[model samples]
Target chain A: MKLSDMQKDKCVRVKSLGVDAHFLNRITSIGITEGTTIRVVRNDRKMPVLVYVRQTLLALNREDCEKIEIEEVA
Target chain B: MNSIALLGQPNSGKSTVFNALTGARQHVGNWPGKTVEKKEGSFTYKGAKYTITDLPGSYGLTGNSDEEKITVDYIKAGHADLVCILVDASQLERSMYMLAEFAGMNVPSVLVLNMMDVAEDKGISVNAGELSRRLGIPVLPFTAADGKGYDRLRDLFETELSSPHLLTSAPNLAEAKSLKEQGEAKYTWITQMLEGVTTTGSLDYKMSRFDRLATAPVLGKFISIGVILLGFIVAMAICMPFMMLGSMFPVLMNEPIANALTAIHIHPWLVSIFSLLIPNTLYFSTAMAAFVLGVNLVFGYLEEKGFIARTAYQFDGVLSKVGLQGKAVAPILMGFGCTIGGTSGTRVMDNWGQKMLAMAIVWAVPCGSIWAVMPVISGMFFPWWGTLLVCVGILAYVFVLMWFVSLVFGKKLSPVETRTGMIMELPPYHKVHWGHIVKEAFYKAGDIFVRAFRTVIVISVIFWVLQYSASGSLEDSLLYKIGTFIEPVTKIFGLGWQSFMTFLSSAFAKEAVLGVLNAIFVGQSSLLDATFHAKTSGVEGMALAQIMSQTIAPAEALALIFACTFNIPCVMALSTTYRESHSLKWTARVAAFYVGSALLLACIVYHIASLFM
Candidate 1:
């Protein structure tokens, strides 16, 4: 399922990130490897989405999330 | 000793990383021929001493912007022993494009995947080993905020330092020849490396309907105006107590100090010296300085916490109403902190048209120093709404100025095709640390005090001499005479010699007008009191109002507005303009525009108001 389709505060694991190759590589270079768990903190439509990744909080826009593919783990 | 260059895009948390690595021991300098700040700090990590240079962040090294050129030149010239590129993990694809460019440079480099916490929370994964193997460099995942991976980074540095032979070969002629041919290969390698360790997932949630509603054209414009109104209201509400505290502090500190000094049976000259130098002007100045300093600290804290940015985003539509766009937003928002700082930030806009527009608009937004004086001016001179009217008038004036600027120098907005993207990293909401706040407060206070004690003090002493030498009174001194000579022109603004003199003294420093006023009316309690005291005693005691009443009408409020608007640029702002723009021509233009427009506006307002009143 698409990561943006999940409810706020829900934990999930990555299945695939659908982003462009260059963007995906950049994500992986930063330790956003497959099988990592992420939790949605705040989901503001049209604004950047806030997520908890590897113990740090990050805010990204819809354009960024659209590139990424995800699955529900919890 | 090995030198590492820290390079990244703006707002990539590079500075935070630099601060975390080398606290308080850094030398900040301007990049050659550019105003972009260059910071260098040294630290002994593990066994080796490393000097770290924090280059100004750029999206790519190919851009024509001064920052990009500086980064590209420094790296190509082999100034850095190791180049550490800090990439935003959240925006990896965009970042990788720049990474590929770096890979082509054939320089020894390391990749820092910052904001890993954010990346993990987004359910993105990376294979660090694979990326490192493909890139032929060590890749470290770091949450720079919490000191994670810093030790591993240090170890990597030490390892690289000990084995200097592992340095990447410089770009060879053959490789340069194959640049076009190998571009795709390099990209493919990066893609495969990314795919090896990364899994993508779909987002389970979509943007809410309300979020869409907020950005709708008509609704967004209204929301934008509402947001700005709220910011103004909050600023005014907060400033009330702030000003009260500021005004009361001088009285609280001055009287007791004066009384204690008075008790000492000393010569009249000694008393005069003590009273004049200690409890009267200088003491009040210090108190005001402290107050201004405190306000700056609070605002700076707000800025660092991203409150100001969020506020700007909320009101961005209203800002666009005045011809301000995304690039211009930051500087205008910063005007709330200090106009000098805001003016300096204009250099960040790469587009010449945008930079000029931002500069012109920044002057319209009053800084905190002006805001601090609002209540005093309103309560003493005019009605309760006076301050609000002045603020609204300034905003309106800015709107018109922006329109005029666009009409003259406006370029077609060609969809703004540039690498600059506004994906601001929002940190989790956290309580502000008082330690950081207080430290920032002291730094700002010290800077302002140093400037006053150095430059403003000289101007004050010169004015003191002029007032002392005049036979009639200090009010009739040479400085006042020159000011009075311009009284006829100023009369349209309803200003007499005293207010005119205040405007003249503002050339030295805008706040100096208040200082000059205090100097002229030290013993007198009020404008009315001063006038009465001056008339009863002698020519010397005649207050500025008494002088002004002879030349200009008392009912003309527009004259005062004109004087406020047309006066010389504040000394601090002048200095900031010179430094930031690095051109005497721009500085002169700013001064001429302010003074010329002010005089013209004052005359028009005076004539219009005279006909009405």
Candidate 2:
């Protein structure tokens, strides 16, 4: 499912990033690669999706999150 | 002396480390032609002197933004004897990406695991020796804020500078030409390097109540406004004392200078300059410096404490309408205090285009002086309700113009790629570091003060000369002749030469517009004469308002108010804009845009008002 579709408190593993090269590189450089675990801290609509990744909190724009594919960690 | 370069991602406490290393010995200037700051300082450690260059922070040496490009180019040029890479020990997994990108650069480096105290609080610990062994470099765990472990760091620095070690276990660089490939390989390498060297306790991730309230869509706006207003009041509290001190300069020095010059048998024009103009210029520059210092101190504290970043996240959706991110909010809010501070504050933006756009939008926000001048001027001609209506109209019009400006200039400044997405790291809230905040405030304010002093001195001297007259006659001065020559064209905007001249002087400084109007419209020869008369009368504000209402027509007064309100803020703002953007062309373009649109706005308002009259 798209990362943007994940609700708050859900843990998901990054399956693939459907973004362009620059964005893909940017996310990867920030430690959000495939198989990385991310917890959705705040996924409120109309707001950037706040997530916990690699001991850091990241705010990703919702539009960009829509392009990111993830799988339920369980 | 050996040289070391500090590199890290944003908010890795690189600045604190730099400040601790080089207390008051640092020199800050622009990097050659770029607006990015270059900070170089020196420190003596155990009788060995070392010069350090604090490179601009970047996510990685990806050459994407100007900061990153400068870092990449600086490193490629082999400028540093040893590169000191700082990473947040609490978040080493994410922060190590820079070291991963630097793996194959073949430069001698030492890894600094900063924020060790924070890491310990999080129940995480790093075996620095093991990590150093794996990375083939010396590693030192440190807490920059507390400033402990510096002795060990100095020893490690000494050892690294004497015998540099290149990374032997760097990530494989084969087939990693593209940024995507490089990022993947780097992250893979970072994971492998951290294996068994770092232990992390399982920490549940949840938004605290405070953060939840701070980022709520509806409530966050009100809360942020309250918080920002409180911040502004605190800034004013800090600023008012300095401003009060500055106001005394004219009173204290003006009479002494006047007596000194007159005793020397100087011409009245020369006497006016030394006595009135010089003191006035000093007073205004001091006011500017004080405001810059206050705004920077308060906002810098907010930024340092991580609240500003939260505000950015909170307002990103709203500001995105104007092709700007949420980070522009602080600077725009600061524009109300002083545009020069706001312009310099635009550095917080991610891209140059956004910085330029943010600065342009800041020009639309009426500054502190404008707020003072607009109400009094509007109140002079119109009744209280009429004045209220005009004030509201001006604000609404400003909002419309800002939207229009973003549409017209946004695409040119910010490209689609730069606007693709926001991937910002929201740092944890930390206590304000007072030492760093004050030093930065003074440093930034001082930089602006010097530039402003240069611009003010030159402009005021020329202004004084043009307005100088041997005989105290308004028409005899060169400025009067120029004003009359331009009167015909300016009349289209419902302004007489006196009002036009007032408009012109407002660009030098906004509050001076009222004084200029009083001088010229009341048939005084020079601004110095108007000031002397006002000082003798002891009732300048009320008397001037009465005289202005009689001297100028309602339409003309309205036009002049709008025109001056929208003029290119001030000479200092222009210089600050140039300093921040470092693009003469864009700066001039924005300035021209304001002047032309300001006149156009005046003309439209005047014609529309005349129709009703």
Give the CA lDDT, 0 to 100, for residue B71 in model 1. Answer: 84
Best by lDDT: 2
Backbone steric clashes in candidate 1, count: 41
DockQ for every model, please. Answer: 0.10, 0.65
Lowest summed-lDDT stretch of 10 residues in model 1 chain B? B527-536
True contacts kept of 2: 0.64
Among these predicted structures, which one has the highest TM-score? 2
Give stretches of model 1 more than 4 Å off: A1-74, B27-29, B41-50, B147-155, B162-189, B200-360, B366-395, B402-459, B469-472, B485-496, B505-550, B554-557, B566-593, B603-613
Chain A TM-score for model 2, please?
0.93
Worst 10 residues of 2 chain B by lDDT: B530-539
Q: Report residue B368 deviation for candidate 1 (angstroms).
A: 7.8
Model 2 root-mean-square deviation: 3.2
User: For model 2, how does the per-residue alpha-carbon lDDT over B308-358 read when each residue is reduced to its tens digit?
Assistant: 788788888888888898988878887887787677678677556678899
State the iRMSD of every prediction, in order shown.
Answer: 9.0, 2.1
